[model samples]
Target: MTNEDFTTFPIDAVSQERLAAQGLRLGLVDTSDAAAFDAWLRADLRGFHQGDPSEKVLKEQREGLAYRRTTGVWDETVDEPVVPVATVNSWPANLTVPGGRTVPAWAISSVTVAPTHRRRGVARAMLESELRTAAALGLPLAMLTVSESSIYGRYGFAPAALAADLVIDTKRARWTGPVPGGNVHFIPNERFVDEVAGVHERYRLSSPGELPVWPLRWQQLAGLTGDDEARKRGLRTLRYADEQGETRGVAIFKIDGGDADFTKHTLHLEHLLAETDDAYAALWRFVLEMDLVSEVRAGLRSVDEPLLWQIADFRGVKAEVQEHQYLRVLDVPVTLESRSYFSDGAITLGVTDDLGFATGVWRVEVANGAATVTETTDAPELTLTVNQLSSVLLGGVRPSTLLRASGSPVPDGMDALFASDRTPWLSVWY
Candidate 1:
């Protein structure tokens, strides 16, 4: 169907049932069409909760858009810095509508489906559309903190990176190093827009799998927008720089009360970007040393985080590791070639994928960070489902690990398989 049709057509329950009766599949939303979709959204919102959303709520969405724009987290970046094309529900920069100018990215605020179309793949459609759009735009990955992990996996989304929490106890934290000297100067949120953007850009380029923060994400973080509510709820952002007037890293945290004795002071680290070991240590040390902050929590950390090695008391830090992200090599040869590999020798990989993304057996040749795939029905070296392939694609899981897993085929040069730059990390969730 045309974009106009997709946007304008009402997909109410009865309509969805009608489509089901005819056996039509879920399709893409026509993002180019604004009118029909806006109307549909208004109708959808009104019917979303079986009542009308007050002007206050609409005002919230708009303010949230402004807040999100400044934080560089929003997918779309506008001239005045508006929310990008693909976004789920977003919060205002502050609690008040039209409250501030800058918007920043924060948590996954909320999601909604128009009433005329419930359970008809609207959410999924929106999600895929957003991710694909981000990928096409070469934006840093999109992310959302999810309450339910299982829901987003189908679309290839993964868990948050940079894992930590405000729950960490500084008393237990053995101080590491003479804290690097840097004046903690608070600038007007707007003044640091360029500085914050520059720091994040440097971080993103170096971080192989880190998410990109649009200007809006920065806006939201700075609390420039009057609309953002979450920041009004007490989200705080900070920046650190060295004696050379160079911005080294940025942190977003929130202080929350905890236990009776401990008082439950918590700081959720949204982002910590560092170029040098000293930078990484300094940034973390600053957080640990925050006065009156009793606990710290961070999430979505790299498997080989330097914090583990830096800590004098290793046992003092608690880490619960889980699978972060799953990636499918859309174009096996290109995907492999895009990443670095440890081995210079060429090995033939007999690959099998049950997932429709890549199916049938194919031969993958790797050498010197270069890969080529050729269709072959011959006896393969590795025969595994798409999930296993996805897991191993990042080089995070060793080839040996895959072979150990049941149903994972070990082709001849199994050792040489997935010999790319340690495991690939999907550090960001989109």
Candidate 2:
């Protein structure tokens, strides 16, 4: 079916049929039925190898489920409580695109299938259902942070962004940046939910590949909820305000491993959000200069973090980069037209999709920093799979690089048109 026709496509029927053929039933979880949803959450957790969750944890999860669209697959042949063998959910979000525009996106998460259900197409059915639902709701893109890198590519999701894990030897490093004129102070953990949420909204709106941080995540970071014991141990929240006393940044971290030797203490950064450069630098300076802390470690950070350059000794900070967020275009024309382009040009893209959601040749034209995409009969200048297109859509991976690696045909100057000024980075995990 054409991309436009997919809006009315009966994906639910397809999902039901596919699962029924395997003697399974796909159904939505009733958010009000805490016991049923909790069982589903436990099954999902077990699929991920997590131990049984506590009652407190189950309650927290149930509360958060109120904000998400959740679905599950159950074995109808089994004569037991109808708990799901697989689970998937999506939250409504706005993804920041190029030129500071936000596009409505469905953020998919909690995708899990029990070991018993593996190889039974349970995950595929749920994923397909989620994508089709998003398309029907008029969302042009769907995104997720994957637990396994190799699993999503076949479904047309590609690594559109990257992040880094940073370990800084604070004892050996010196700050070389201009003295940040901001004041950093400790804030009560309870204030983190409201304070950081507001700051993050401002930050994510201007940052590419960023999505809105949900309320549950904010509470989890603030130590107000969740089952992570490591996050709560020695947890502290620090706020950075400009010299004018306007709060601009906040950091949640925990201090670990300083029993005998104070120098053995490590500051593990859980979440840090800054609205301005001065505030960012100020927070880093605060952490790097903290007493008794030997090293500072943070993960899921943008690969292009300026702190590496701000330090006098760059070698003291060890950084490991890894692929993070993946994006899939549900509608080729709408997805391309939604984002701003770097240069003015026209190219016919022959997009092949096994799922048939984004398959077709379309002419994508760019002019004056804007783009227009339309289906065309003209011969395509470049032919690639939907996964490859997604990889280069955010401008993180160059089309030329993929072409050279795969030995695929390349249109001249395609790299220039696709390259972004800044490397795309995703700082949060779903």
Candidate 3:
């Protein structure tokens, strides 16, 4: 969809009206004008405390800006400097749901407001506008990877997926899993875009909370372009192919900090994609057995990765869990009915939403592992805010836990109906 189609913002109308009284205007960036768009980027970088971009970095950023719809909060009272005080951008994409279905989603990112603009309602104004636009586009959900944990809860967003930070002492761990019969080869970094995209497409389909990786991201990850050359130095790319010569897995990583002792080299995994369990095992085994690698570390991995189980001594691996993806429900009935349930039952829920998008009574009925949600006037069996509902929607948090924490009334079998056999996981950052 075009950027213009995603620019409507009815939820922030009240905030805009209030800001106008103070001589500020919240509006879309003039992407058609190159100079105006660059000014917006500079303002955004300043808010994040990043240095001025080099020419190469600016060119790459301009390519990505084409895919996003950007908005800014401008101080119209100033005539000389027209740069905005705050910036936000979003793009439309499909996100995988619990039942192996893809639902319309708004991917929000690049959120920032100048230090001078804080406490003036700039952040709230931009977020409300994005949420309202997503609802108007008939999207069921909006998702983001937050820079801070405490900022988005008041906007009816909650942690919906969890990830793990893994560190493995390669010297202590011994591989015990069946040896995968795949041929692994080193490939040039320039060919990564075409080679890895196919494997990642198959992998992300069955993975919940995954969004399609855009082309610009693939280029950046492969070190074909962008800033951070210091981190990209000595990067290596590996591709795994089966006996039939079909590529099924790929990995990008780098070794650092040997410090004149080859045994002290540390391997950092940047990204790994596998289409099959055998391919997954092969990739991990290859990395674990590499010469002179003292340790391996990766962040934002699935909590249930099989590498921990494949080692002879599980204690060699250490994992720390953290929240990854936060979700906000945009349409109550559709979002509830889209995912499958575990048990056959019925329950009424009264969801309170400050934005009024999902604020209503819903009767969710399930039978034979399918759910049907409809509007109902019956008294709700449970009552909670939209943020609480989002936490439990993916089965990441138990309904009983939320009920006890909030002191809300819970019906008899609500836990059995909402829990999932698999823990919800999301590995992608944005």
lDDT of 1: 0.48
Q: lDDT of candidate 3?
A: 0.81
Clashes of each: 82, 0, 0
Worst 10 residues of 1 by lDDT: 94-103
lDDT of 2 by residue, 309-330 (tens): 8887989999998899899988
lDDT of 2 at 418: 78
Q: Candidate 3, residues 283-333: lDDT per residue as tens digits?
A: 888999989898998878888788888998898889998888898998988
Sequence-dependent TM-score of model 1: 0.66
Please rank every candidate by lDDT, starting with the best: 2, 3, 1
RMSD of 2: 2.9
TM-score of each: 0.66, 0.94, 0.93
Report lDDT (Cα) of residue 206, candidate 1.
42
lDDT leader:
2
- Residue pairs with colliding backbones in model 3 are none
Q: Which stretches of candidate 2 lie over 4 Å from their true place?
A: 1-11, 77-80, 227-233
Candidate 1 local lDDT, residue 247: 74
- lDDT tens digits by residue: candidate 1, 266-301: 777765656555567777887887776766787666
Task: Please report, in order, the local distance difference test score of every candidate based on alpha carbons.
Answer: 0.48, 0.83, 0.81
